[model samples]
Target chain A: MTVETLLLVAAALFGIGVYGALSQQSFVMIMMGLELMLSGAILATGTLWAMAAGGTPKGQLLAIVLVTVMAVEMAIGFALVVNVYRIRKADITEKLKTLRG
Target chain B: MTDVLFWIMSGISVLSAWRVFRTDSMVRAAYWLMVSFAAVAVILVLLSAEFLGLVLLLMLAGEMTIMAVFMVMFMMNPAGLNPMTMVHQHRAAIAAGVLSFLGLGAVGVFGRFPAGVSFATRDVTARLGMELLNDSMLIFQTAGVTLLATMIGALAIASRRGRYGLADEDSIEPAVENSQNAGEGPPSTEKGSA
Candidate 1:
């Protein structure tokens, strides 16, 4: 398949991820949505890399870095979630109504 | 052959992503997300990005496992046992998502891209590393430092016991022992009583 087709798929995945992040109440599900968005970004970068002049490796490298960043992001984010659960005893984002102001 | 593989991987990735958000339990959702990432990794491999595909698999698998463990340890709900409803404020989100997808797809399909180029060499991984290191080794080092900071920060935040505190001081064992001792009559009080 062409790079354009891959870009289209990535765009679709990104859109779905954004929808999940905005609509889902569960914190873990929201994180899952964010992961989907990152996955789309990785695909788009890889496709661009494959299409670049002189077959640029920069895009692939960037994708590698992004995968690492996503891992670290998930680690820290879940750590924070654990701390929040300890204090609040709830995992649902909607239940964080204490900050509704 | 390549086209068929691409279609299959794409379908698997998208379906698993949908499953991630649709599942009621957080642990199940995390596992579904892992499956989605694995499918995407396969797609990356098909694109000849072998290094990136393997890295994606390793990173996402580790992440999903950690998330599942955190859910069991900290979330108020029982570990994968409690039933939940996965409801959402979905109308606006659905509209926005659909519109964005249509807009992007239209752009991708209609936009003019550079002329097609044939692959001259097969060592894509080596080419990728050379190009990456040549252009911006500084940025690569910076990313490494950022990851280090994340690791340290996560440990700082998640570690329950400080240097001075006892681990499990408030655990169930002490409470259960106290209750059992109370039931068995206060440790033979008649030894000192007249």
Candidate 2:
């Protein structure tokens, strides 16, 4: 309800995202973790925009940029995943011990 | 009423996000993430960002579906037919998660923040559109171009064949198809000139 409350929730979400990103072995799952982290960031920025920044469109614009970054990350992440799977038959991060080829 | 709705939506967001990694099935994990984002979208709506909130919901629907499909396609046990733990560094990760939460929560609770309120007399969506076209036009255009480039790059990377040759196969020139050049090595003209 309050700004602090929203920020707390965003922080919690970000923390969960960190845990997931560090723990997950699959590249896809790792990307999911990254997405979660961005989700938290977006929430925090949106909260600031709505409450602290006087609902300025600039804050919203920043949120939009973050979303765009998410999209680009997902697209390229999946593309590299497919490429890795094709080249080395790898989906797990451990399988990729070397970046060669 | 708004306060109650905010609490519920935030609770849903957090719980579903937690469930994203907890779930065994990859597709379930992806959808749980979708649910989490959707809840956050609702919270955004509660915060008076009607356009951004709705747009978030719309985008997540498609994005999460692609995530689910990719998980199924690329993962071995996509459906979680058998129990498998696909994680490492569990203790360290937990510690990091806790530490980050504590650190950020401290900031949220203790930090001094500005108290400016958005007393918008105009519609929020209309204002956003105006901002997009006026000051943020360059940023908007850049994002569009970036998305277009990402689409092309992803397609090129994911495709089995490229301009040169099949990915699995070394960059072998396509055998010359013309009768004069039949069975001959690739011409010196250029590659992919089959």
Candidate 3:
């Protein structure tokens, strides 16, 4: 109903996303977390556009850019995951220690 | 009426996002994420961003399906037949999540944002189109190029064969002196001496 309410909801989504990203071992699950975080960002941006930005097209454009970023991130992330899985029979974060060096 | 719908969609998005990490099955997690996205799209529409909301739905449908397929392909327990806790540092993560939420929520509540309401009758989609083709044209073209590059890069990374050899195999360029041999065939498949 109000901008604050929408923003609070956005914050909640972002928080849950943080938990998911940090706690999950699976790469896909971690990505899901990032996606959730971006979802929050989109919602917040839309709320601001509707309530505070006087319906400016730039706010919506920003949201669209965020969406595009999400797509690029997902594409590259899955590609890396597939590659890693192919090279080593593992997908969890713990097993990616070889990447540290 | 709109207030009720807003609250409902907000609840749906948050709950489904929470469910994404809680579910054991990878497919369930991915689809749960999809549900969360769908609910957020509804909220966007309620906020009068009809075009953006619809586009979100369209983009996510394909993306989430791919995610589900990838989960099934790579996860050890795709169906979560065996209960497993594949997490570490759970307490710290929870603390961080809560703290970040509190901080952000406080900002949202306390921050003095400008007060302006969008007119419901305005054709936002047309305005957005004009913006894209006018002042924002460069940014729009840049995004298109970026997406094209991402597609090519993803393909190159995921493909089995690369410029030199099989991606899984140790790939090394053939020695320059061996040009005669290299010229006779497809990029040498021989695993180069490391």
True interface contacts reproduced, per candidate: 0.52, 0.72, 0.70
For each candidate, the DockQ is 0.37, 0.49, 0.50
TM-score of chain B, candidates 1 onward in order: 0.73, 0.82, 0.84
Computed on alpha carbons, the lDDT of every model, listed in order, comes to 0.74, 0.88, 0.88
> What residue pairs clash in candidate 1, if any at all?
none
Better of 1 and 2 by lDDT: 2
Measured by C-alpha RMSD in angstroms, how accurate is candidate 1? 8.4
Summarize candidate 2's per-residue lDDT along A1-101 as a digit string, tens digits. 77899999999999999999999999999998899899999999998888888887888999999999999999999999988887777889887766756
TM-score, candidate number 3 = 0.90
Give the Å shift of residue B65 in candidate 3. 0.8
Candidate 3: residue B21 lDDT (0-100): 84
Cα lDDT of model 1 by residue, A1-101, tens digit: 88678888887888888888888777776787788888888887777666644456766767878887787878788877765565455577765655311
Candidate 3 per-residue lDDT, tens place, B1-194, comes to 99999899999999999888887888898899999999999999988899999999999999999999999998899988887878878999899889889988998899889976654446989999999999999999999999999999999989998877888785322233245566776435654532
lDDT by residue (tens digit), candidate 2, B8-115 = 999999999999998889999999999999999999888878888899999989999999999999899899889889999999999998899899889888887897
lDDT per residue, candidate 3, A6-71, as tens digits? 999999999998888888888988899889889989999998988998888988999999999999
Which segments of model 2 are wrong by more than 4 Å? Answer: B116-122, B171-194
